[model samples]
Target: MESARIPFTERYHATQHGGIARAANSSVTCKTAAGRTATPCAAVQQGGAGANGHYRMAYIDVDSDARTANSSSATLRIPAGSRVSYARLYWGGSLRGSGQKAAKDNGRVLLAEPGGRYRQVRADTMTGHRPHSATEGFQASAEVTELVRNSGGGAYTVAQINMATGHSTAGVWGGWTLVAAYENKKQPLRRIALWDGFQSLGADRRELSVRLPGLRIPANSHGLAGVVAYDGDRGHGNDTLTVRAGQHRAHTVRDTANPANDVMNSTVTDLGRPTMRWPAYRNTLGFDSDVFDITPALRSGGDRLTFRFTTTRNPGYLLGALFVQTDTRR
Candidate 1:
């Protein structure tokens, strides 16, 4: 089955609430190497190695609980019946130094799970600072599907750059933006129905039609089935429902005036009045369970299915809902 992707952005700020990294020498005073006065610095200095090294990088620590206080961490919930099959994380920002080492120092964006486990989502090796220029930084992304799937379909969480490791590098100083992609699990048997709240058919309107597109049938699938529910003005009249592919008739269900006459083939009931009255009919046509099949009616290269209704009396028939089902193939 084909999958669907849902994209969501993190709901937190990267720098607020003590999320940035600052080195011990981040505020060090710079003195002229030979014979000049020390200069006051505004940004962390680049180059040099040691405890008081000048290179320092800031990072956002994305914590699951930080969503309320910091906003850098986020939790995405999967719907109750659906499972997550795949996921990915995207993040990007700027680096402030040059050369391979500075680029390597860019660190990585980490994805954190609920139980203190973490995985590297993407590397932030984009380096070089272009001050006051249109082009300024590098952007990167990473796939976190395994971690997301392991989280078991609910509350998948993520952390900002270097937060999971608690180690900060120099020459990396920009806020990061993040978004996640997820694929929903596929169902073995799928049902597509037509029951939009505000639509129906009647005497004023004699026919109702619906077009369903993009339905996929796996190579190992068995077949398809369909059912429809309908009613008339006084629970009287003969009507027919048809399923088609372009001009090809796939299946049809016909209603009779006498409920008892079609009792074995349909369900006849009185379901209220005005809003819903009696003489409602529900039936499934084309093949019984032993040999149920409708694949031959479906066009091989196309995925368009159409449903139609016709009536023969005044205050004709109002269609309720039409449902089509297909076997699930692993």
Candidate 2:
């Protein structure tokens, strides 16, 4: 844990370009409660795939075509008249349940853009994998900006994620998110920044602080934050995300759909609807692709903003992505 924790580093950073949108879905499914709370439900209905404390889990095979071993599709919606400037796909899970053979298969996957055939894609960026008891969590990503720029937006399916499917001491979990930043002259000038790495939540570093520069916040500006992480429990409590304008006091970003104490709980959330996905599960069992408002935390006229993610007394989590979008001076 010490070795894996000390080296929390960066994977991808956008040099330039686009508004932000994400298409995400869980690769695994399990039986759980109805309302999708941390509280255990005795009813144990067949719910969408997510990180739950109870029930057996399995891979989600939404792609009946079945040219690959495992596959799932998610919807990436870019507004009309917008061109994609950047896109990255992230996927991983516990290799322990699937046996160590998958360790060699890390960073390799299949991605199919809307109306296109399957193409091999590898994690051209950082690959984060660490061991914790019986569960070894790993996350890998690949840049698909070119594919996305040409293909536009729709249901994008990813296959061969190479994650385990079943109940484990740590709970079987894996998923993918297609995050794209677009350019639309019709929209307000905005800054879209993305940062990713294999950073630990509690093992060695309890906090992740990212400083983003060259942002201008005007009055009545809209802001958003997005994240991808692994192994976060449903109600482990004490997890928080905070953001601050340069030289200003920090404010904890809050949302009704997301609990401050459990920011990493499994789920893929967007702004209340237009939720297009193949298997839109409220809980992803262990994977998380969450979005929340940071507009309340913004201050006018800043060249930089700092983003922080911290855990006080929760089990470990490996953060894979951090994205920020805000209106800026063109």
Candidate 3:
């Protein structure tokens, strides 16, 4: 089969203009587990010389309609048979308060879905904590690929906030942003590609392999396409990278110049100097880009599909990210 080029398209969604308060009203008041509630932005001083400090807390409720009734919802609707390649949440905002030193607080944003399913989208110990007295700015983000996949095209009812501490001195205010990338075409149920986050590969961990999760393929897939971004190589000679499925050897990856033996129409991109170094190497090295096809070895056996890789030399190549495209039976 001819090689296929899979391109990714991206879109961003965000809440209405103005702060979180304007987006949705605080329906539920903040209360401690012991049923203790403090006035909003009211500083509670702590006693003792060693404990020379104070904190505050408050709770805000983000209305479902207000949060999703914006341009971001445009990509929420996934075409039938198509899948989301990637989804992430980018959130940032300023906190209002009055204090000599900037107040610090930890909070969580909950994504409340239908059927009573609640997922904590963002959780951090220090958010919106600044040193300035009048106000402080902070930001937090997370990858929600799995969350988007599980949503099943249902809308999130609300983005709930939970303040663990320092709520009184600083009132939480921010906007929620959603960014998603989807496949352009409606892929068949059998043909799908799951992106696995960056996998670290080194001399100690030479072979990097991952099994496709939550996939039920009764028979062998028609073809397999694999794309990887790698950096930090130590070797100069031509090193061969092998792709395998179970015990079957699929494709051997080498310099893209040798296209005669390359069946996947593999391509490479050279990403100059290494910004960072792995433990094995103390100095920076060049990086390599690879995109290839491994259809020959992508057969299903024992109800599991696993991809493995091994290099001829210790290039010290760190596998940045991997995406596997294959066809399975419906």
Per-model lDDT:
0.30, 0.72, 0.34
Q: Comparing 1 and 2 by lDDT, which wins?
A: 2
Error of 1 at 161 (Å): 55
TM-score of each: 0.29, 0.87, 0.35
| Rank order (by lDDT, best first) | 2, 3, 1
Residue 226 accuracy (lDDT) in model 3: 35
Steric overlap count per candidate: 5, 6, 7
Compare the candidates by lDDT and give the number of the best one. 2
What RMSD does each model have against the real structure? 26.8, 3.8, 19.4
Q: In model 1, what lDDT does residue 26 have? A: 10
Model 3 residue 193 lDDT score: 45
lDDT of 3 by residue, 269-316 (tens): 211111111111111112122334454555542234455554444423
> Per-residue lDDT of 1-330 in model 2, one digit per residue for the tens?
112332433443433335888988878766443343534432221233234435456677877675676788888888888888778888877775534435667888899999888899988765777765555778888899999999998989988887776556566778888888888877777878887777777755789887887666775677888888887765566778888887777888656656776677665777433257777766667777887888777755467778888987545577878887887765
The local lDDT score (0 to 100) that residue 152 gets in candidate 3 is 40
Q: Which ten residues in a row have the lowest lDDT in candidate 3?
A: 44-53
Query: Could you give candidate 1's per-residue lDDT for residues 1-330 as a string of tens digits?
Result: 101111112211111111111000010112212112211122112211111112232232334454321113333435444443334343323333232222342335555554545555554222222233211223334445466556643233344432111112221222222222223344344423222111223435566666665455443333343222222222233555556654455555332321321211222211111101111112101000001134555534234566665665543322322334443222
